[model samples]
Target: MRKLTLLFSILLVSLVSAQTLQDSITFNPQQQLNAAQRILSGNYGKAVTVGAYGEVTYNQPEALNGELDIQRLVLLFGYKFNEKTQFVTEVEFEHVQEVFIEQAFVNYNVAPNVNLRGGLMLVPFGIINEFHEPTTFNGVERPSVDNVIVPTTWREIGFGVSGKLNNLSLGYQAYVFNGFQSTSFDGEGGVNGVLKGSNGLRSGRQKAIQSTIDSPTLSMKLDYYGISGLRLGLSGYFGDTQAEDDVEEIDGANIGISMIGLDARYAYQRFTARGQYVHGSLSGTEDYNNLTGKDLGSELQGWYLEAAYNLLPQEKTQRLFAFARYEQYDTHAGTDGALARNDAYNRNDLTTGLSYHLAPGVVLKGDYQFRDNAVSGGEVANRLNFGIGVWF
Candidate 1:
């Protein structure tokens, strides 16, 4: 695989170089975009960018309890198809155990006013839903609400459009993908019972939970960036998730999710302020009776807010930044019937950290966090973490 990748890279470089030579012989500012595409050999220049991030988190369940562990590595790559089209990918490795491709998509610019993308793309549900980077956020970590309910970096198969009018940027996307499955509905109990510990619920099977060829999900997003360095967005999704020929006879799951987000930064004289908020709910039927019977749905919800400041200004070469964040979520909100009865359903986390720049595209960071589990008998969790991140 590595050899094949290297060969492809070399071929692409050769093509790009040839095109660049031709473009130099016939250069025109008015036709720069077209020239770039031609030089790229197709529509865009054969360009590639790569990035990676790694983190380790420690949390103590209580003052006396030992720390729990959380860690991950995230990598991203993009291929420019032109000014109008690109291919992007994101992969994640959890606990240094295994790697999974989180996102892989092709984006096409239909017009200056419209665009379309498909493949395994982010679900476009909430503000931080699509781009949840640890260093990018204000706090030591993302919000609890985002993790449990809105589910950041959530993706499915779909397509949509985005563009600019005047000073405002407008965008939207619709996709057909898998929806959430209920634990109680399929004898899985709840996310808390099934995913964290026992795996009784059929929902435990993330690999099995996918959109069938016959039925696909739909999701969309609307975003604006008219204000200098300020971004505002809202998104929603509705979908059906059901298994075929299952013993439970569960018909399908219905879900409605929504979120609003705001972000801004002023990089004058080496100072910056950035923040984002996202809230959403998950509702649908679960196989409770183990007989394909539907039950009252649960409300899963969460949100996060953060802020950051750069300690050393105008020293991009010697990077130094400080940030903090608070996040919370409840997986079993307002559910009537269940084996757990909302117990072990709530989580709150607070994090603060500092980062140092190792190079133009590299960084090292360390942080500490405090966690609370309202449902887990008020257990308190805390931990320290450090890691590295880079982009090229």
Candidate 2:
């Protein structure tokens, strides 16, 4: 009896120590070195780290059959070479069939506030493009503006520098990356263009799969969080699209692009709010449209605003938040050549949802979306969505 009691006491003490250690570690997502530094500072002397995040969703559109899908499953792998260098990668599976390399990068800390990174990296555009973990946002589906305008999950092969100023509570990133491919040769003496009026540059993403580069693009972002509960971001991208070697000399093979974005997020007690605006201007669209027989737009714009309130007490480990968002986007905000603006490309969405945080890295979400377009006599297809998300 005494031996068993002693063993129980030892186990209890060890468990208490582990719990204490875990409770003492705190992380700030707004910090530039949050991910890499967390691993190096924690991990209990381990050099290798593994993590994952995923989401499963069900959608039911009005007058349409419901569909259930494993929207995304991503596995994270990281290796800490030393105090100053680390490698991180995320492998993603979409819809249970398609596989993608979402992010693969090497970060080298050169100074206390500066780091250099390279490889396939997410573009630091709007909020969702860079901070897209499933549990990080409230809605079951991402804001439509992020999808249609900012083009979430947009990443490219690049090298750049990122750092934060502790005193100023500011972060910055700047990189030179391979731009989108506007037109590519099909190898059968035919040419195909990916840019269109409906989705702007979304379909032009090469995703680093044998990506070709005709011109290097400049992308940069600045974030400020000096205010207690507010964060602001400004981003910009400028470049010309790439074309296949065969089409490089063509009159309208590529287009020049300039995009800018602004976003803000705030949290005060149990209330939170966020907003974003993105605008893009395309040059040479008239010539490209005539040559490719496509209706590509000259200007694209989108914006969204959201607010949420937590319903649960702060002392509890779980939380429930009710949120509402409004989004507006226009892919054909302007047109060039003989092309006319398409009212159907001007869209808006109103979404209201509840996100239940069952634990720190797990959540259940439900939302209703009223979707519409500017086209005359167009029918609206509202949707109901439910989803489960997890991150670890």
Best by TM-score: 2
Q: Model-by-model lDDT, in order?
A: 0.50, 0.84
Candidates in order, TM-scores: namely 0.69, 0.91
Flag regions of model 1 displaced more than 4 Å. 1-44, 47-86, 90-97, 133-135, 138-141, 181-214, 246-278, 284-297, 337-343, 375-377
Query: For each predicted model, how many residue pairs clash, with residues at least 3 apart or on different chains?
Result: 25, 0
Q: What is candidate 2's local distance difference test score?
A: 0.84
Give the per-residue lDDT digits (tens) of candidate 2, residues 175-243. 999999999776787678889988999999999999999889999999999987788999999999998
Q: RMSD of model 2, in Å?
A: 7.2
Sliding window of 10 residues with minimal summed lDDT for model 1: 25-34
Candidate 1 — what's its lDDT?
0.50
- lDDT by residue (87-125, candidate 1, tens digit) is 866667777666667677677878766666667666666
Candidate 2 stretches with Cα past 4 Å from truth are 1-44
